[model samples]
Target chain A: MTVIALDVGGTSMKAALVPAPAEPGAGGEDVLASESWPTDRTDPVGGILDFAAHMAARAKALGRPARAAGIAIPGIVDEASGTAVHAANLNWRDVPMLHLAEERLGIPVAVGHDVRTGGLAEAVLGAGRDAGDFVFVAIGTGIAAALILGGGTYPGVSGWSGEVGHIVVRPGGEDCACGNRGCLETYASAASIARRYTALAAVPAGHSTPNGSVNVRAEDVIARAGTDETAARVWSEALDCLADSLAATTLLLDPGLFVLGGGLAQAGPALLEPLEARLAERLLFRPAPPLAVTRLGDRAAVHGAAILASRLL
Target chain B: MTVIALDVGGTSMKAALVPAPAEPGAGGEDVLASESWPTDRTDPVGGILDFAAHMAARAKALGRPARAAGIAIPGIVDEASGTAVHAANLNWRDVPMLHLAEERLGIPVAVGHDVRTGGLAEAVLGAGRDAGDFVFVAIGTGIAAALILGGGTYPGVSGWSGEVGHIVVRPGGEDCACGNRGCLETYASAASIARRYTALAAVPAGHSTPNGSVNVRAEDVIARAGTDETAARVWSEALDCLADSLAATTLLLDPGLFVLGGGLAQAGPALLEPLEARLAERLLFRPAPPLAVTRLGDRAAVHGAAILASRLL
Candidate 1:
């Protein structure tokens, strides 16, 4: 059997045609075909339909027609109902994702929340493969987490679990887009870190420290944190907020391991060392879980989508 | 076969003999014998051994030979190792409870953490019996929660998953015993509520609202919340903090039901009504999980110990 997987993001979609596992307990299927498309932004649903149809056609031409497909997308998704409740960035709501995909491609389609799909992938094949229970946190433009239990995603009753970014780590510190004050995302997200750093330090015109930034990126700030005073303060604050949030996450779930994904994790030891120290110090009694960087990187969700599609077989 | 159950606490110990089910898939085990003894604060370990010996003898005298036993205690416990890691109130550390109990009682003894056991009871037979994926929080002197996953306790890798009390509801608000500021316990636990109210309110010359206290108890403060200004402020603050913590809990775990246990839950609607309201108000997009009061009350842990003993069968 063949399956098609699509990871729909805010800017683009990564779609792949992967053959289902040949045997019940075998290794992964080889990617029979794959493609990437810029999301319509104005008409994401239509773009998804067109791309999926094209993938199905390509799979058929390659003599490996996909029997089913799975999609992972941003925003509130009702996986059980296969509906996209809302996608603020896409300006879409109540788009029956499963129906539209199945109708367009003539195959069963599974829809899942993006972070959760990434979490599932990590739990089964990435950083948390050996860990019993773990929280997979992605800290990029935003910070969110997926609680992986028994080697699968434990999406909440209302399917709103893992909104760690919105949790009030700072209480009344700063205004959050969610109408809250001092949320973890407001202080710790890569975007927030860059924004805060930009507000504090003026980037020199000749500044060049690897990954060039138009202004000053989170990476640029973190790179200069060792020597620059302003960068040090901003970077330290972000780490403190992240450590504080992780502390709360530990207290609530007591996950065996915390798998840090997304762009911020690229800082590697710089992020992990301080975070590990803060979490261990804060959690005085029990041992803090090991924090690891994601191995699958950005492709984690796409692989997870294929895994989800394979389950449909 | 018969099994002994013991719930060791800071103030007292509740012990009982739970008979093995006569037939498979039965409702519950019959209580063959029961007893309670005031715990010796100075010699908690000795008190526990004496109480367990007495309970085992009582069970044997009643024509029921005990084959196994289960003990629950207040502290940082490693259930797998049968070790009570730490109990500050009891001034104990690294006590190999399982080994000592088996040596003295001549039976297989299962040692479980007190709050986790209470959460087990609530999940299997009390307020949380019907709720799916619930969190059982005991709000006495300090607040702690247990994640009841798949009808069992989700003890973390190091057996310390449910320390929700330490989650900072207000950063830098009040110093917590765990060396943190603005922990959930500092604002929402029964002890905290009463302490804060005492500092803020003047009790009436003649005031009695069940659970009696000379100055003011949590119950008294809650009882006067509707009429007294100071009581109202304190009560509201506590509820708000609780609401905030629960919101974070909901976001992280997405529990179907929240089983509120411990002393303050005795306030019933006074606590639940405001909490439910606040949680619902704060969670604008998602529906709030129903918060229910624990039915077994103080006996919840003892019953859980009995249940654990039965599992030994």
Candidate 2:
């Protein structure tokens, strides 16, 4: 089966022509032709549809003859209804994305939350293969998660499920973009850590470190862990916050495995080792599950979209 | 067809002979026989077996020829393995509950977590009949929850799921019996509310009320909400904490309804109304599900056990 897959991101959109059954591991051979495009968020809805049409057209030009297309977007999406309910970053609400794409591309379209689509990919063809129950937590600019249970990605009834980022971790420690105080995202997310380190660098000498001295991004802070005291402190606190939230999730869900994804997961052992140790400490009697970085990396959503599209075909 | 149902609690045990195909929404009728006994915590493993034997003897004496037995118990129980993994309150670990019951009763036995079994009763026969996805949250001395998805209770992989009370809501607020700081149980449980109120009463002149001196239990706190400022403050905070956790749950697993049970749920509209409003505020764009009190009250677990027993028969 051949299908067109489009993964919409904040800065870029990836499009792919994939053939199934996709290979069952990282760096597999099932993926055929793939390409990328810069995403323009000026007119987010138009940008999304145009990108989908462009991907479909490219596949057609290549004689792939794609029967269906899948688009994965970042935000709350109602997969059952084929609607993008809300995307704060994209400034979209209630966009009938599937219907629009179907009309323009003249093919069946499967619309899904980006993280859920990525999780679907992992569950079916990557790290979570053969696992009946698992949580796919993607840590990017902000944190979110997808739950795969009994062979499907469970989109909570309201299409707002898997927003693990907003779970309160500190209660009253820091204000979040969500208007809540001390949400998990305010501490553990890449964006949050960067913001925290930047703020700390601004403090006057003899007191706390000044935010101006840091001028470091999330990756820069992560790189300085061994040499920079400030970076190590910020990173340590971030890990602690994440471990706290994951422990809470473990207590409630008792998932067999946790597949970590998104940009921050590239830190690999730096992120996993301490997280595993801390989760073990916090859990009362439940055994902690194995935690691993997603095998698909940045392409997970596109791969997952391909899987969904193939199913439609 | 008739079967035996046993509900084991920390302090007492209740057993009933239930007719098969139990009536919907009401406690089953034609209870051929019923018995009660004190739950002996010392040597809890032996006590559980003894309790099952007593119920079996009573059933046999009634001459109903009960065909199967269902038992429900608190704590982390592995229903599939018929073992009570851990019950901190009961001080039992890996108790082979099913084998003991089967040996004593000489009948097929079904075992399950108490709250989850109660949720099964509601999902199949009570207030949750219409909800495809819902959570059954029972707030007693400690709080726990059961997830009902796709017409069944999700026991999770390790059978240690649904420990919702341990989800960190206060982060670093109060010490929990689980040795964690600021678990949700520290603020929203029936025990916590009473404790908070008692702490307020211990304060000196600063605690004196405009109307009169006040001392309140959890039940009294509910009653004094309209007139007493202290009671209202504590009650409202409890409601807020509950809403925060429920909102997080919704974000992760968007259930269609929340069925509240146990002692605290007796507060009814006072709890439901505020919880609904607060949850709505936390939700970004999705619609909030209806919140209702469980119709079965304290008897839900026993009824659920009866349903499971009937299935076995």
What does candidate 2's lDDT look like per residue over A140-207, in tens digits?
A: 88899999999899887777778889887776678888887778889888888888877775643234
DockQ of candidate 1 (2 decimals): 0.63
Listed per model in order, the count of residue pairs whose N, CA or C atoms clash below 3 Å is 0, 5
lDDT of 1 at B78: 92
**What is candidate 1's CA lDDT for residue B282?**
69
> What is candidate 1's lDDT per residue for A66-156, written digit by digit as tens?
8989899887888999999887678888889999898888888899999899888887777888789899999988888988987778888
> What is the lDDT of every predicted structure here?
0.83, 0.82
**Each candidate: RMSD:** 3.9, 4.0
| Top-scoring candidate (DockQ) | 2
- Per-model TM-score, in order, reads 0.90, 0.91
Runs in model 2 deviating more than 4 A are: A23-29, A203-215, B23-32, B57-63, B203-217, B225-230
**lDDT tens digits, residues B93-156, model 1?**
8999999999999988899988899999887778888677899989988888888988789887
Cα lDDT tens digits, model 2, B1-313, are 6788888853588878887756564445446777777787677667767877776676678776778888899888889878888887898878888988888778899998999998988887778987889999999888989999888899989887778888878766789988888888999898889788767755433355545645445887788889877778988989988997887778778789999998998989989998999999877556777899998787788888898887774
